[model samples]
Target: MKALIIAATAAASLVSTAALAQQAAPQNPGPVIPGVCTYYNARLLAQSSAGQAVETRMQQLAQEVQGELQPYATAIQTEATALQSGGASIPADQLNQRRQALQQRAQEAQQLEATRENELRYTLGTQRQKITEAVSPILTALYQEKGCGLLLDRESVFMMNPAMDLTDVAIQRLNAALPTLTFNRMPVPAQ
Candidate 1:
């Protein structure tokens, strides 16, 4: 049994060694195609100065919304405190009515919060679309200048020549084009 265990251990070690060697071997990516290029759109958007500005603005808007909602939150806390502290002295009918009123207020607060969230989402989505639109021309210009006929997202390709990466150049062009974006919370449409 001991001899069998030793053989099994040796076999496992050999298998693992072979697997590691295969993983470490450099893959032979074929020669670059002349008209094909790739760019990481997500990286371009996330790392650009304009994108950072938008994120900062979004955080400011969230803080503003929280400020606007603070009074409602305070009111809810006050009402809950009153109920918890003085419930035994109150008549049962009056207590029920107060509880119902509190529930109603809470529900209204939630609805208002949801509306605010929707507004933020709408604003952010519209802003992102605008950013994409602004980037489109830059991307087109880069592709044309590079003599590229095919543009692929970097995420779509497993491996490519470093020269084919257009992300950094695109970001530079994007920064030159749009330094910062100005936006506000768009009103949620009636639903």
Candidate 2:
């Protein structure tokens, strides 16, 4: 009966010790550090005023190309209409030949369009790189000044309080620092 009482006391002591240990565990209940979290989108920065200027220039170039190609496009349409109207009067072989010629012309037009697209992409990519390069030093300065411990992309964040957003500040700083940045002009080959 004494051994049973001692065993019961020991079990109670162990349980009490465990409960005490759990309660003694340390916890952090302090407020979070300000400026420790930051986020921005480099793409958005690139699309600012400087980026818009680059796009405007590209659009102008496209318009010029379109003007030059307008006559050819009209000629192609006219020829197609003529072929359609003269259908059976044209020999089968001749008709096939004309069709092939029209197909070739269409392919050429498509090729020109593809080339222009590639050129525009290259131009835009180069401009974007320039903008990124210019903005990086400013971003580094901002990070240092703001004491940002973690910087993330705006797009990657699911939810962020308005206070957490530094994009507007960055944009304002960038715009002030670089009001108008000229992109590297793409060289056109002389005919």
Highest lDDT model number? 1
Alpha-carbon lDDT, every model: 0.79, 0.63
Cα RMSD (angstroms) for every candidate in the order listed:
13.8, 22.4
- TM-score top scorer: 1
Candidate 2, lDDT over the whole model: 0.63
Weakest lDDT window of 10 consecutive positions for candidate 2: 1-10
Residue 78 miss distance in model 2 (angstroms):
2.1
Residue clash pairs of candidate 1: none
- Listed in order, each prediction's TM-score against the native is 0.77, 0.68
What is the C-alpha RMSD, rounded to one decimal, of candidate 2?
A: 22.4
> Candidate 1: misplaced stretches above 4 Å?
1-31
